[model samples]
Target: MNEQLEFVVRAAAIGTGATAVMDLWGLFLKRTLAIPPLDYAWVGRWIGHFPRGRFAHANIAQAPRIRGETPVGWVAHYTIGIVFAALLMAVWGLDWARDPTLLPALVVGMSTVVAPFFIMQPAFGAGIAASKTHNPSTARLRGLITHLSFGVGLYAAALFSAHLFPI
Candidate 1:
């Protein structure tokens, strides 16, 4: 394979693996803290409306339901994870994946919070950084923690990859 292509392949693997780690963390939080996991169905509903000319919602729960929204949401969730992983590779380079450092992975992971804070939140009607939610500050804090976890996930995935591939 070409050098760039090899990088992309490795990046995809790392990103997807990292996302899986993040998801496991989410499950742990839900079980330990009694916090309900995110309902990707809402994310699907939000995305489903795009073609119909809707972009933002006052409350996603109030939005019309979409068929197969759960599956769609899950797909989006994992896909987003892969994208984040790819982004980590892009910024830190494939060498990071080979060596598996901490700061770079964590930094990239935390920075991903912007997507939910500004894009996903506002689009879902929660406002920027979840400002429109009933408890905006709490919501924001949770989001930060979640993103930080993702950063940790990135590190874990990279470490695992290094162990497995050992290139």
Candidate 2:
């Protein structure tokens, strides 16, 4: 396959893998830990509560239910994953996508938690660095673990795809 096509395939694989991992994490958190599934609709309602400060950061737990559309939030979530994968490729090359190491990939993936803690969560009104949650430490830890799993998923998917395609 051409290099461009290869890149696209690898990036998509990474993104899909990350999404799957995240979904599994959500499921486990809900089923095992009794945490509710993250609802983008609720998040939308929360954002809508403050029309003037729609984009401003606040504590999501305290913010009113989201009221507007949810597609933007969902898109942002997946796009972040895709961007992470692309960055990995840029740093380590296409070969890394096929055989991603745990250290670098996990590190990169975990690093992504900062964005949600400081940016998206706050923008959604979660709080700066998870300050709104009753148990911020646990939430932060869960986020880290989940993102690490996503990195592992990316590696596993790349390996499987490589096996299927054989370079």
- Give the alpha carbon lDDT tens digit for every residue of 1-167 in model 2: 89889888888778777767787878888899898756665445544655565666454555554444487556656776787887878888988776667677777777777877887667766677767878889778877777777777667766776776666
Please list the C-alpha lDDT of all candidates, in the order they appear: 0.83, 0.71
lDDT of 1 by residue, 94-132 (tens): 788889789998898889989999899999888999888
TM-scores, all models, native as reference: 0.93, 0.80
lDDT of 2: 0.71
Report the number of clashing residue pairs per model: 0, 11
Q: Which residue runs of candidate 2 sit more than 4 Å off their true CA positions?
A: 42-53, 57-68
Q: Candidate 2, 122: how far from true, in Å?
A: 1.6
